[model samples]
Target: METLANLESFIRSAEHGSFSEAARWLSLTPAAVSRNVAMLERNLGVRLFHRSTRKLTLTEAGESFRLAISDSLSGIQAAIAGIAGDGGEPAGVLKLSLAPTFGVAHILPLLPGFLERYPRIKPEWHFENRQVDLIAEGYDVAIGGGFDLSPTVVARTLAPAHVIAVASPGYMADKTPPREPADLQAFRGIVMRSLQSGRVRHWTMRDVTGREAPVRLQESFVVNDPSAMRGAALLGMGVAMLATADVLADLENGALVRLAPRWYSDAGAISMYFPSRTLLPAKTRAFIDWVVNAFEAEKLAERFAGSLDLRSSRSG
Candidate 1:
């Protein structure tokens, strides 16, 4: 009989298309994943993937097996959730994937209060800078940003906060602040790009007076994450355009300054999305409520006003 270990490894490998990627998804070593696949192959007497230098390709037998068993596995998962309801709340391990920065800046602070409210929902946080496949990875929920989630998932918007154009106090002293969006081309800046969004970070901004039109920026560095780009700006590397929440503490301490607030468009929204289904566990629903309320109770909306406002903490 094929062991569960072998079956799981094969499924992950097929989903990821590489042993290393599958291992990363499972929090295991590539060698361990390879071993599991090998064990499965030995039991079934069939090669699953045709390994080659170019790329891994699923064999005919492998494709058929995936189609047959994937839904069965999902049904098994639903059964587990049903059984875990004996506690009368969310009683299963929840695998949550999120951006590392958002996880730190927002979710971590909110968690203590949330945990105090619900003792039954134990959360396992997975922090990654990359987008994860919820279905393939079996994640219960994920916190995403500026993303249009797949049709299979139900995305819920929690709070939308404006992004601000910001720079360090030191950088502003050396570089004259751009009087308007067009002047951004004259200053050094950073751009944050991700798999989910566009790369027009330095392009333009607007107010009630219609769009300011397109403009180019003198980018000194380009990074894949907002937090990393913000760190570079904090070290006086260059200016950065960031979400209000991401730099709330620094702006409060006068470490960073927002420039010409009128030149910025509304950006940055905190959101939580989950797989679309008829039956959601009570624990999951409780968590969603706890988190949304926490943000509202903390006056997360008010924080945005002063986050990168280039003003003193006293004003906040």
Candidate 2:
């Protein structure tokens, strides 16, 4: 049988990466949390962490324990809430982190309807270009775009971008249009870094064999910001490769043109991600449902191919 105190400590510690962070959340000193975990380990007779100089990693036992405890705690919380009527209405603070462009492009704009629909639920937004771990960073929800996610954290697709190649009319005016992936090698190549790997992901196209064909980089420019890359492409700085949502307006307005040779990129869906809804607070559930509905109602399917620059003039 798991002791309730030990379970609580484990959950809190897992939710916050640092002992100090867990302590702060639990209103206990770091020493106290560490001591509690130590005793719990003694009781179980197992090592939980692989201690090292650089970073903390979980052993197999620790990983299994964490997952078990998460489910157990969720069950307990649901039971308690079942009696307390916490699931009756939406009411609480939802802490969230999101990419800057997403926050501005999708969430922030559509927030008015969500807030109006659920006045009782207040969401605190943290918009940054960095990846936020929901459990480790004390965030209730995180909006992210990537091919995959961490094992410890849970996520749902909110919005994913359709990958596409774009360049400004200003840049393409005098140059020959690229009709193939290798053709980009002759032109100045722009690169964007992946937030997950900290490595630059080459703008790749697909081959008839359904294999990834990488676009050659001529080293024209490199940038981390998708929005800025669009701007650079607009200024004729270089060929900008990004999500279709990043340049839908420019493409439509003739400021930018498609670099489609091999039918290069497709739009990726945006998804709303969180830890778990098994024992979700009413507020969080309500907001999640509302956001999903709003996403559909607003015809957000066209989010990738439309001009988001219209946002400066109108709010969607």
Candidate 3:
């Protein structure tokens, strides 16, 4: 029988396509991972990977072998973990991928409570701006908007991702506020260019009563990140369309003022994503529950509804 370490090393190396990356995830040296994979190939009498200077590519047999044993390996690991007392307490490195600004502003605050509850689960989080490959990158969970849900992954929405036009009070002081979404064309627009498409993004704003209008802002300034756009808007540069959850504090404190508040863009949902629920690790499950519960208790869903009046929503 092949050792579990050998199997794990081979599987991780295959998933990451680089021994160095596999080593980082597995807490082993690249040489160790390479040796383990070589040993596994020798034992099975088949070459699993095409070795090269840059990366590893799965051979035909290797792909077949991986598909055959991947699920089985997960089962075995879970079983071993159960026997080793992991089932009783969630203890492991819970790797997470989170959006930088929103993660810091909203999710980071909950870390203390989470750690207090599950002290044994050490968090290894990466703050990033892009949607991560949950399985390929080996993340336990990811929190953001607009993730492409694969067959192996599941998404639970935490709140609506509503985008609304905003501008600094100083910027708006010199101009008349737009009465409708289309009227925004007259103002200087601080807009975001799509990083994936390399084109300026446009929005169709919808009112509460279902009236939709195309909003065209004068792309006076362009950026690739939301945080930078928000900053520019705050500096009285121009109007920007930003998520309610991202600018909640700014809107609340009167640093930024909403424009055509009745009209907003539905960007999709801010969600928590993880691998399939089958054999889900205790730590991942625990963190998911904690965040969902907190969103409910705090009524963030209502607050994040861009079509609703923030002041009235809070007052009521």
Candidate 4:
């Protein structure tokens, strides 16, 4: 029987297409991961990877073998954890992927309490803007919006991702505020261009009564990041459409005012994602429950929902 270490090395190497990346995720040296994979191949009497300087490509036999064992690996690990008394207390490195600004503003603040409750579990978090492949990247959990849900992953919604027009109070003070989405055309716009597509994003604003209107801003300032756009708006440059969660503090502090308060663009839901498995790691389960409970206690779901914005009640 092949050792679990050797099997794990092979599987991770295959998933990452590089021994160095596999080693990073496995917390092993590249040489160690390579040696274990070589040992596995020797025991199986079949080569699993095409060795190259750039990347390791799976051989036909390797692909077949990976398919056979990939699903079983999680179950085996879970069983081992259970036997090792993991169920009694969660203790391990919990890897997470989170959006940069949102993570720092919201989730990072929760870290103190989370660490207090689960001191044994060390958090390894990456702050990034792009969506990650949770299973292939070996992340314990990911928090973001608009991730394509794969069959192997599960998404639990934390809040509505609603985009609303906003500007610094100074900017809107001298200008007639937008009454609806179409009225937004009158103001100078701070807009975001997609880093991947290089195209300015457009939105359709909707009201509480299910009314929709296309929104096109007069692009006075173009930025690739939401944070930059918010900064520009704060400088009295132009009106910006931003996620409610991103600017909630600014709005509450009266630094920024919502334009067309009754209108918002539905971007989807901010979600916590994890691999779908028969049994999750105790650390992952604990973190998930903790976040869910925190969101509930804070009523963040309602706060992040533009359709449910408190200002909307007083707006025409």
TM-score of 4: 0.74
Write down the RMSD of candidate 4 (Cα, Å).
Answer: 11.5
Candidate 4 per-residue C-alpha lDDT over 1-316 given as tens digits, one digit per residue, 9 for 90 to 100: 8888999999999989999999999999999999999999998999999999999999999999999998899899998877577545877899999988789888999999899999999999999989999988899999998889888889999999999999887877777777889999998999999999999999999999999999999988898998899889889998899999988888888888888998899999999999975578778899999999999999999998899766532123
List residue ranges in candidate 3 displaced over 4 A: 1-84, 312-316
Error of 3 at 113 (Å): 1.1
Off by over 4 Å in 2: 1-83, 147-152, 158-160, 193-199, 207-212, 265-269, 298-316
Q: How do all the candidates rank in terms of lDDT, highest first?
A: 3, 4, 1, 2
User: How far off is residue 231 in model 3, in Å?
Assistant: 0.5
Cα-lDDT of candidate 1: 0.73
lDDT winner: 3
Better model by lDDT: candidate 3 vs candidate 4: 3
Cα lDDT of model 3 by residue, 1-316, tens digit: 9999999999999999999999999999999999999999999999999999988999999999999999999999998877577445787899999988799888999999999999999999999999999999999999998999899999999999999988888888868888699889999999999989999999999999999999989999999998999999999998899999999989889888888878899999999999998878888889999999999999999999997876422111
* TM values, all candidates: 0.65, 0.64, 0.74, 0.74
Q: What TM-score would candidate 1 get against the native?
A: 0.65
Lowest-scoring 10 consecutive residues by lDDT in candidate 2? Answer: 307-316
Evaluate all candidate structures by whole-model CA lDDT and list the values in order.
0.73, 0.69, 0.91, 0.90
Candidate RMSDs in Å, in order, are 13.6, 13.0, 11.7, 11.5
As for TM-score, the candidate ahead, 1 or 3, is 3
Worst 10 residues of 1 by lDDT: 307-316
